[model samples]
Target chain A: MSHVSSSPKVRGGRKAAVGNVGRPPVAWALPGILFFALFAIVPLAIAVYLSFCHWDGLNSPTSAGTANWTRLFKDPEFRQAAWLSLLLTTISWVFQTPVALLLGVWAAGRQRSRAVLSAIFFVPLLLSTTAIAMLFHALLDPNFGVIKEIGPWFGIDPNIMGSSTGALLTVAFVGGWQFMPFHTLIYQGGTRQIPQVLYQAAEIDGAGMFRQFFHITLPQLRNTITTSSVLMIVGSLTYFDTVLIMTKGGPGTDTTILPYLMYRTGFQTYDLGYAAAIATALVVVATAISLILVRFSGFGNMRSTREGM
Target chain B: MSIDTRPVTRPARPLNRTRPAGAARRRRWGNPLAGLGSLVWLVLVIVPLYTLVSSSLMHQDEALNGDPLAFPTNPTLENYRTVLDSGFFTMLSNTAIVAVATTAIVLVLSIPVAYVAVRTRSRLSGLAFRTFLLGVAIPAQAVIVPLYLLISKMGLYDSLPAIILPTAAFAMPVAVLILSGTMRDVSEEMYEAMALDGASPLRMLWQLAIPMSKAGISTVAIYTALQAWNGFLFPLILTQSEENRVLTLGLFNFMSQFGVNIPAILAAIVLSVVPIFAVYLVARKALVNGLMGVGGK
Candidate 1:
């Protein structure tokens, strides 16, 4: 055995000169490709195909040929859902970015107390979204929740969830509360990666704290901002669980973003065809937005910030 | 230039006057405005968490009638008992199985793909990599209806495999990206060294690539596990039976089952978090890094 192994090892050593030594065959990628194709890619194609077919998910799907597509264009609920999804995406991006950026920068500091507080802040991220939604739902219960006692002091109505705007804002707020820490951690990582020399240079130039932040930190985090924003936008566009648990797209479909609308249309109303159309549209929009962001920010290029260094 | 001279002359009189040596060295003296902002956010984070815990410990009557933020006069595990009695364990086990199975599948499948992508210089490998890159933006929500159809057609509806298969599939993109990233870091010389031993590609992967990419592997495992554990839409739409229910759906059902029983609901929420919280406490750096990896870092 030893003699045979030695002979092959010698041959392998010689073969190394040919440059095909230990490279894996492309066949190694087959199982994964087939599995992803079967589940993800195939299902996506079926969704688009079913978008043009009429199926109540019962007997069989019959070709309806642009019927569902036309309905989707003119459906008032679909229009409203599309608009609300865009609005929520904007709200989430606007609300989450500044706070997460600031908190991330702060937590990136080396203070011991900041470390502890950062740990505390990370607690929400550990909880499942279901738990956070449930916790917030219970807290916002008008008759029996903390909101009742605190609303008067804050000059706010306790029945915030009962109104349309309040309900939508509440969804955005709850989602923000759960996700801000994740973005903050991203920003924190980005901040730590910044070299200390930049800060020293700004200090030598008599730049105030605000000026340094505006000029040095902000520009340096441009990639981080794009990354966090893309994530935030896509995340909020598909925001569903909170709507399901808290609002159920209620108070007159006010909070019915696209995902929730898809859920309602497909499962509840049994309009699976229309829901497929909506789902396809969502995929297109999400992919388009990400592609645009990646294109503009050159994030797809994966350029290193420390190029010269 | 004038402003620069003023700060140089009176450096000790401004924000740096009362700071520690470390702060002065880094020029990160506590900004009062930022400090104030952090305090405000601290309150925002703490208040609801305080309410969740405090209310869960109270009797339902106390929770309803008393201040929601007050300390429970007589804290008890009775609510936790209530959650335990209501089949929380079954759902917990189901979630655990889903998480484990999904992680296993994702790792077993994605590692090879990632390895081939990183090691092989071929157009097929490039196409495979781009396939996953595009897969990243295809939200699982978009494919749910067809998945439901496919699962039902395959006789998988209302089964754990129904959840495991799709969840694992969706987690592939990130897992592939992360694994390929780490695999790329395994140096050429290392492969050459292994090749000199007459090692097959499989042996090279096991001995060298896998060991070298342990960080990315662990990150992928954690990401898939969390994705499976917290998955809602798949469970909500695909599965119907209580026997097949996972934790998130279990929590969703608890709302209607324990209606107006706020303490019971809160207790269920807290119990659901306990396992992940324990993991977070012990493996915080790994967990945070894994989550950051989800954003394609």
Candidate 2:
């Protein structure tokens, strides 16, 4: 009020003194700054610091220096999990993204038709991951379950968890199934952004469904596709609970991805320091991936333009 | 970063128009195969969900001798009852408590933080936002040991607050990101208009900023609730007693103990899903309103 009422000189003096810093937006900023510092920043610092030590979960651990790091490079289990995470993420994203966009586009073509299909696809996503994992667990039981019930129809055995290859595929396939709805939802929104006139014009120009899809729909959905894929990749790379509930990383350590390995090391083996280091590495890797996705996906630019507006 | 080696970061090729839709359809139209192709995809998804739902209703005896996909000859709620009677109510209550607590904390904390992120748009707040994004990147497993240590050191282990605080912290980040995205959309002129009327910072927030940012706030609030409700790992590691068990942890226990009781586990699974189901069922309208609040980006 005083700033509003004060003379030009007084207001000018105040602005100059403040160096036009806008007073830190302290009213809205302070609480968040304080909360995140305690909750987010502090924990991160602890994780990073603990990464340098060799503390057993129960007691003090000597600083093992780079022994843990060196060991991580050579650990067959780590390599396997790393490969599995990368493979599943890349593969699932491969299968999930294009298919989801196609569905989203088809759905966007009509109203009621799309909503019902969208709801079905989104159902698995909305349900508990545990439920989905359990559902797959029962389905893959190989004894009395449906897969076993029809095991001989294709001369296939119901042995999803019986082998390393099978376990990885089961995890990947289920992950893809449960998560497709997210891509659909994102792609639906992106498809919605494309003007209907663009499609109609294409039709008038004798452009067929393939042409419209390739010429218009595909191009329009680029941002949405990228965002969904990035999310899928991140979720798969950190895959733990689903695998834990379904296979316990069993049939061997074949299924133990980086996250599962991290948990096993820290909690089961009681190597707190080693777990922290593994976690730190996971975090570093995840952060790099996240940066690439957010920066290159065209989202930052889109949002920045909106902000400027 | 492997991103340097990967071609994904490169520009995607422009869509190559090989075959136009009419010509493509004409090529396949007489075959009745395109319809069949889509049906196959739909069936693949539908079959599993159908099997799960139907199998849940089957009596134990029927499930064994009968076709797996058949509707149960005698549908029984006994499985549902057995799960209900087996202390699942407590798990639901505990999960509800944690989810509610976390959601409440996230709403209170994230609103202001997101608001500031929008207003300042400064390097510091930007850095702070990135720090929060650390939560998104760093899987909870990575920091679980230290987090457990931190909680226990504070003598907070196995407590609902132990679960609640970490979940909120983990979620606070994306909550802020989404909220800030929405908050930034609120025009600066609203603040200017309020300042002209001599509105205090607090009054402006209550009267203007919040009301304007409701959609984003709701998105964060609702998503935070979902995260808390479905959260598995934290509660799995933190809670010891049944009294402290969240539904996710409870579901795991129920599955292991009653692993063979298909109906009962199904009932438990059904019961476990009720809160979210109820929310989805009852709040469909609100969800649509909220869904429009955010996009994939």
Worst 10 residues of 2 chain B by lDDT: B1-10
Q: Evaluate residue B296 in candidate 2 and report its C-alpha lDDT on the 0 to 100 scale.
A: 34
List, residue by residue over A212-268, the lDDT tens digit for candidate 2: 778877777776665666667777887788899888888888788888888888888
lDDT by residue for model 1 (A1-309), tens? 222222211222333473987789999899999999999999999999999998898969999999999999999999999999999899888899999998888876756677777777888887788888899899989999999988889887999999999998899999999998889888877776666667767778787777878887888888888878877888899889999999999888999999999999999999899899999999999999988887888665445565556
Candidate 2 local lDDT, residue A14: 30
Give stretches of model 1 more than 4 Å off.
Answer: A1-18, A204-207, B1-30, B196-199, B295-297
- CA shift of A149, model 1, Å: 1.6
C-alpha lDDT (0 to 100) for residue B248 of candidate 1 = 97
How do the predictions measure up, each by TM-score?
0.90, 0.86
Model 1: per-residue Cα lDDT at residue A13: 39
Best by TM-score: 1
Residue A221 of model 2, lDDT score = 72
lDDT of 1 by residue, B106-223 (tens): 9999999999998887999899998887787898899999999999999999999999999999999879987887776666666777787889999989998998788788879987
Task: Put down candidate 2 lDDT per residue, B165-261, tens digits, no spaces.
Answer: 8888888877877786766555554555565566666776778668866777777777778778888888988779878988888888888788688
Error of 2 at A88 (Å): 1.5
